[model samples]
Target: MKTVLFDYGNVVSLPQAPEDVARLASYVTGAEPGFEDRYWEVRLDFDRGSLDPAAYWSHVYGRPMDGAGLDEVVALDVASWSRPNEETVAIVDELAKVGVPMALLSNMPVCVAEGIDTLPFMRPIGPRFYSGRMGLVKPEAEIFHETVAWLGVAPGDLVFVDDRLENVAAAERAGLAAVHFRDAAALREDLKTLLG
Candidate 1:
């Protein structure tokens, strides 16, 4: 049986709200022009569990952070990415109703993963893999192999959906079928063709 593996950010959840991102930046004193750039610069390391919350925030802030400050920033950061994409979520629901095997793979930090796991939509997806917990991130073949192994399925039996083309390409290289997720509508059509 084929298992549909979905990417969490952008695919499952909507893009992080701009205002919420701004709130996270506010925690950085004298935030500069390239705050977003800085955030992404070390984000993979943060997502890969190489850097813990305090260290990650400190690097993004370009200075050391206090405990209270870190707490607020972490909460705000998690909240920023917490909004659900109702359309995609509906697709997940439909798949679940039919007993389609589904799983989630996300390059998310542990803190954010914890927050995301609490959402009602996430419950139907089993054996969710987070880069932070696995010490690996997507667009890397190893993570794909590891996930395939964990699922006890051949790589070709998994249909991986990701918004990022690079990750899609990597999944293809890893021998899993891949879909470049543009939106829920496109994804639904793709799944019909692939799953049929």
Candidate 2:
């Protein structure tokens, strides 16, 4: 394969600090007692560019955030997305050893996505496709095509790995080979078979 598109959250990284989801749920509860389930929908809206981030944030909180509160929210949620998986990094290194051009494709918020440049793996991971930056989200079809275009590879020459089945299905629909990511070991085995 000439290109391998990777998903970051769950597939590559996770909440680094801890209790992030629970904390977010608590924050949402302050606005609406039972709004936690709505949080994911809001996040998806933000990622897919269906709603402007500030507007979404305001809607979620039921009020506009002060600059400091906004900064805190971004820092607490987006910037705290997580640390990289060493095993996944090793797999990326293995893929690199064979000269496969890899790109990261993730539904990430702009604040966290921008901080990706700080990662060594991300630096060498070819062009990253952050939904916030691209104003597109996966399962959308365009992102898959766009990433392939960015990598200058045919969809058939690319493999996409993501934790979400819908996202993987979308990759398949877009004519790229797809892998459903479970964990480091499963991913290692799958990639070993794919790239070995």
Cα lDDT of model 2 by residue, 106-193, tens digit = 9876766766757666665867888887878888999888888877878888788999999999999999888999887898787767
Tell me the spans in candidate 1 whose CA falls farther than 4 Å from its real position. none
Error of 2 at 152 (Å): 1.2
TM-score, predicted candidate 2 vs. hidden true structure: 0.86
TM-score, per-candidate, Cα-based: 0.97, 0.86
Backbone clash count, each prediction separately: 0, 0
lDDT of 1 at 164: 99
Q: Pick the TM-score winner.
A: 1
